[model samples]
Target: MRAAWAIYKRELVGTFCSPLAYAVMVSFLLFNGVVFYFFMDLVASNPSLSGTRGPLQLFFGSTILSVLTLMIFCPATTMRAFAEEWRSRTAETLLTAPVTDLQVVLAKFMGSMTLYAALWVPTLLYALVVRRYGAVDWGALSAAYAGVMLVGGAFVSIGLLASSLAASQVTAFVTSFGVIGGAMFALGLGRYVFTEESQLRFFSYVNLWEHMEHFAVGMMDSRQVVYYGSVVVLALSLTVRALAARREA
Candidate 1:
């Protein structure tokens, strides 16, 4: 347990101390600020389009832009976990440490997630800014952030899983991006492939679009909780297994 915490702190410090972290932060804020301006402008130009009275609902996780942002940023964030170590032939050294594979995996995962959460922390300012201009739905805003974090969990775990498998950071990012994008495409394909209502409902249950929409409206579905939680566990478990396998190799 102590070894795990030590590994976690080491991973956390490695991630935060890197220049990549700052670059990702600046890029995320810059892109998101532009998206915010675009939405606010659209809403302002057509008053009726301001359905929720603020941009938080749309900006948090509702739009494809939000999805794309994650697709782009998360891979870069998690790619170096094991991939870089492997690339530099340090993975053997890392894995041979006293900590168990499970601890190492969890440590790297939590480190990536910490940075993921940091990227969203700035968006709280969006809520503050919205409050100054109009009545902000703080509950809904809170729910939106919660939903986004869960969504981040799903993707960040996937990224780390990919990182564990690949030999280099760039390859890890591509692997992570491809798998995540393919899964999303397959889910979207369900609309046309499954004609039955029950099948449709099942696919929708796993759909990121509806997941964010529900959260944006302050609707917390238990099914989504289970879905996201299950994905997180599955991905992280796979990561641990990958680390164990690598240790043996």
Candidate 2:
């Protein structure tokens, strides 16, 4: 635990020190600000467009853009986890340390998760701003944030897995982006093509769009929890295996 904590601190500090991390943070805020502005414009043009949904819900995952934000920045933030270590030939030193593979993976994962959470912190003001003008459903807002965290966790794990497979940060970013973006596109397409209840159910099971919608409405389905939990576990497990194989090689 002590070793893991040390690695975790190093990882977090390293990320904060990187200029790319700040670039990502700024870009994320800019993109989200534009998205929210667009939503407000939409509601202004057509008051009925939002209906019962609040800004938080629409901002979270009700739109494709919101999901795209996750698909893009999550990879951007995690691209360097292992890829940079390998690129600079520092991975060998880390791997050869006294830390076990599991501890290293967990520590790095937590570090990435912490950074991911930081990226979302500034957005909380969006909620507060909304509360001042109108009624905000705190329960749904909390659920929406929870859902975003789950999605971020899953994406971070996938990004780490991609980093493990790639030797450079750019390659890691592209790999993670393609895998996550492709899956999201494919699942969304499947949702439309499969109109049958059973088929739609299957798509919905893995559809991030549906997951966010459920959360945005305060419908905390246990199935949604299980789905994302499985994704996080599976991706991280594969990441651990990938690191082990790399070590052996």
Candidate 3:
């Protein structure tokens, strides 16, 4: 446990010190700022708008915005997890340092999640900013944050596994992106590809966009929670095994 903690602290410090992390954070905030401004401005200028939803809902809705954010930042944050260690020949030193593979994987997963959380931390101000012009739904915004964290657990673990499997950082990033994007797209196809209602319902359970959309409106469905929870566990388990294989090789 001490070893794991040490590794976690080291990785977190490394991430915080990296120019890449700062660049990614700044880029994420800028992109979200533009999106928020556009949505809020639209709401203010258009008086004929329906009372169906708020800017927060649209921000977290089943659009390409969240997806784009994940696509860019998650990979940039995680692509170097184990890949850089292997590249620099430091992985063997750590793997042989009287630490279990599980601990190592957990440390990396957690370190990446810390960086991931920092990426989203700036968006909290969006609520306060919007409060100036409109009433913010605190309940739904809370749910949205929970939903993002839940999905990030799985997404970061998946990226960690990709890093463990790849020998280079670029390859790891591309692999992780492909895995995450392909899984999302494949699950979404269930709505159009399936004829049976029951089958479609199963597919809907794993649809990342729909899951977040549900959270955006303040509904925390148990099925979606279990889906993401399972993904996080499964991905991390595979990552541990992958790292073990690399260590033993």
TM-scores of the models, in the given order?
A: 0.94, 0.95, 0.95
**Residue pairs in candidate 3 whose N, alpha carbon or C atoms collide under 3 angstroms:** none
Q: For model 1, give the 10-residue run with minimal summed lDDT.
A: 184-193
Best-to-worst order by lDDT is 2, 3, 1
**TM-score of model 2 (CA atoms):** 0.95
Q: Global lDDT of each model?
A: 0.82, 0.85, 0.84
Runs in model 2 deviating more than 4 A are none
Q: Which candidate would rank higher by lDDT, 1 or 2?
A: 2
Supply every candidate's count of residue pairs whose N, Cα or C atoms clash at under 3 angstroms.
0, 0, 0
Q: What is the C-alpha RMSD of each candidate to the true structure, in Å?
A: 1.6, 1.5, 1.4
- Tell me the spans in candidate 3 whose CA falls farther than 4 Å from its real position: 48-50
Give the per-residue lDDT digits (tens) of candidate 2, residues 87-109: 89888899899988889888989
Tens digit per residue, CA lDDT, model 1, 1-249: 888788789888888888989999999999999998887676668778677646777786567887788777888789999898888887778777777788888888888989999998998887787677666888988888888888888889999999999988889999999977788535855765788999888888777776777788788878888988888899999998887787678
- Model 1's TM-score against the true structure: 0.94
On residues 108-221, what C-alpha lDDT tens digit does candidate 3 reach at each position?
Answer: 988999999988888888888878777888998899889888888888888999999898989999998898888854676687778798988888777777777888888897
